[model samples]
Target: MLVVRVVPVGRARLVGAAVRRRLVPALTGSAPTASILTTPARCNSQLAADAHRRRHKNVITGPDAVALRLHRGHLVVQHPRWPVDDAFFSLAWLRDHCRCRHCYDNSTFQRKTDVRQLSSVGNPLHFNVNSTGTVLEIIWHDGHQSEYSMRWLWENSYVGARHREQRQSRLWQRCLWDGRRTSAEDLTSVVYDSFMTTEEGVRRLMKGFLTHGAAVVTGVAPTPAATQAVVERVGVVQHTMFGGVWEFTADGRHADTAYGRDELLPHTDGTYYSEPPGVQVFHCLAHHGHGGETTLVDGFAALNSLHQADPAAYELLSRVPCAGEYRDPSRRLHMVGDGPVIAHRAGAEPTPDSLLRLRFNPYDRAAARRGEPAEVEAFYGAYGRLTELLWDARRRLRLKLRPGTVILIDNWRVLHGRASFTGRRHMCGAYMARSDVLSRARSVGLLI
Candidate 1:
């Protein structure tokens, strides 16, 4: 007799659905006859004993093995490790997802055949849970075989409780850090050469950047390419019309004052773009100066304090959109956008969402907003309060970036500025997308 089987590879599993088939001549007393009738799933005691020999790497004994059971037409898994149990998948899903060599193409990781055409009569003839209880082997009415791993089952397990867990994870708010408390030691900095050359260094730097929305790497080449190299360690450097990794000097010709020798305020760049830049990088190439320090303010940290002090003010700023404009006469370029001074989830009530980006550029900010008289007044009041909190001396961290120093900022979350300089201070920098930064983190298993 010819039998076909599909099974999961390694440690992934599934369980779920309907079936059909034909009865053999010996059973039908005639030539092969089709039978569309559905039948109950039967457990196989012999195959179950044989499957016991193949142990799963992550299995536990005793009560843990009791975590799995057949309920009606479904395979129910009760794992104490995670809060939720997977009791949703049917036998059909388990059968259809078989990853056996005949059923799946291992090289391309693609399914060889469709499962939807399986007859309703295709119920399991027998099933076995291995010693680790992580794998389940099954035999179907048509003599089809399958092996499923518990890890795959749990990863795909989705139910009402799963959504609740998702919401809980999303509500995480970063702890506020100010100058006095969060110093170079707290935020931590990686050596530039090591970060570019080693996996451990890249992971360490990524950890700090992901955790704080900013990080520092020292001992670079003090050049534009050096800044690009730091960013490229994780992902490619994103280019804009401003060009890739351009140098910033007092004498360089550019539309923005960032090219000139002026002290900038704590603000996020690229608010003028519809889709603002995600991550911004800066490298100090030469520093023969007195005051070219970089300033960073934790915008979310500021919002937390503001939320505690004044709910009305916080709500107003989070609701009202402010204006940002960048105009270059030489290039005949004009860019503008209006968004919340403090970006967050948009709703009538104030519930802090994960992303709390700040866009406070006094120089780039347009004139006072025009709106409903009362709403506009409340917005201005909230704006003033937030500015006061952001500019507070204690809240800002000032770092004198020397040559060979690179600072990376999350343009969406952290606000940055420059301390005025007198002598020649040249800086080179680049910008990268937020997605690439995060993709590299996942690629290295730093994030899942």
Candidate 2:
């Protein structure tokens, strides 16, 4: 009779040794045995065929491991690799690469590095089935080893492969003053005459909105009454203590002193409201005043900068939930939500067409009111970082709104602020609900 035995080597040698120590001595009759030797026919071609089929089915190929044997989508692994099988690889790894400023630092946009540029040292870059044939371990060329359950590798591999695409699609342009001269014509062409009341005009306007978060409408009467009339036709206007009906004036008020400063930081208005207005309409009744240049920033651009500079920070912010608050002697509101400073609706990819939102306010007293010091500290950390990005000159679009102009913005997507005024200034501003705008678009058959 011919006998053959398979043995594991290297790290697997111990298992091989143990198996041989127990079985070989018994088979050779040195140890007492209960049964006698069987006939040669007992180990027939059928048995060999069955064994061969099982072995062939068990081997894994390509970047995947063999233990993760999938037959018609069924997971057949009895055991999985370490760290690789843990959910950390799937969740933490991706979160660490989130392309939002809350998770990254936007100010370092130009310094951001690409993940594909990472160096792969001598780590075993592939997975191999262990000697026991029950699990797989990823071998790095550097001699580092990580075991992953077959299912875990499969799931994470899918996500890991998708990371680059997600990152690229979410990448946005950073609007900066390049020191290069921009012609007034270019600026006017980019921002003005973007809104339309006609079918083709509406199409162009929507397309512009998708490309730029805000656009200017020319040929509209520059008066406050004219601006308010347009706003009312599209949606209900949001009125606030800082509100006015016509070309109203904006000076720093004691209650909300942000607008009073000569230089204003980039920020979204109505952040304190539970459901802040989603769009803002600003009409220039007069621009004879000095400074007070209206600045608009693409929040997506700022977010992309952060994602490039500090991925770890970006991940932390995106994973953590935050509370935004607004309070005064007369009114108070609080909002608790989970999202990055820049985020799209869940299950959707972020794009220029995606709805973008930002939350920035320094005067949140929710933590003190609720007596949560840790939460407050975390919120402040995120807020302080975001503030730094807001004032970054490179990410802002500075413009002076001339009389006879109306600007419409997706408030959630663009952060608007002024560049301080030294003389008499007049402007009219109102909020248009997002629901109403979409409804208006649909009513006019602009959107299906």
lDDT for every model?
Answer: 0.67, 0.49
Q: In lDDT terms, which candidate is top?
A: 1
Where does candidate 2 stray beyond 4 Å? Answer: 1-197, 239-247, 250-254, 258-261, 330-343, 348-355, 363-382, 441-448
List, residue by residue over 1-448, the lDDT tens digit for candidate 1. Answer: 3222333323322232212122222212343323322222223332233223322222323322223334445655444444554555576667667889878888999997576554352446655554333465777667888876655655544433455446534533245688878775676599977897888888887777877878889888877776777888878888876888777789858778788778887888887776677788988888786888898888778888888899889877766777888888888888887887777644324545444467777778776555677787778788888889888878788888888878888888788888888988877888888789879876665653
lDDT of 1: 0.67
Going through the candidates in the order shown, the clash numbers are 22, 18
TM-score of each: 0.69, 0.51
TM-score, cand. 2 vs. native: 0.51
Q: Residue by residue across 1-448, what tens digits does model 2's lDDT show?
A: 2223332222321111111111112112232211111111112233234323554242322222222222221223322222233222232232233334444465774323344533322212333344433334443333444444333343345433454345434433223221133322233222233343444555455444444667666677777777876566556777655554634555544255444636766677666566567888887776565788777776666666555675544544554544555545554523433234454566665533343466654444234344246655665565566567666776667777887777778787678777877766776778877777767655644443
Which ten-residue region of model 2 has the weakest summed lDDT?
Answer: 13-22
Off by over 4 Å in 1: 1-77, 85-149, 156-175, 345-353, 366-373
Score residue 342 of candidate 1 by CA lDDT: 71
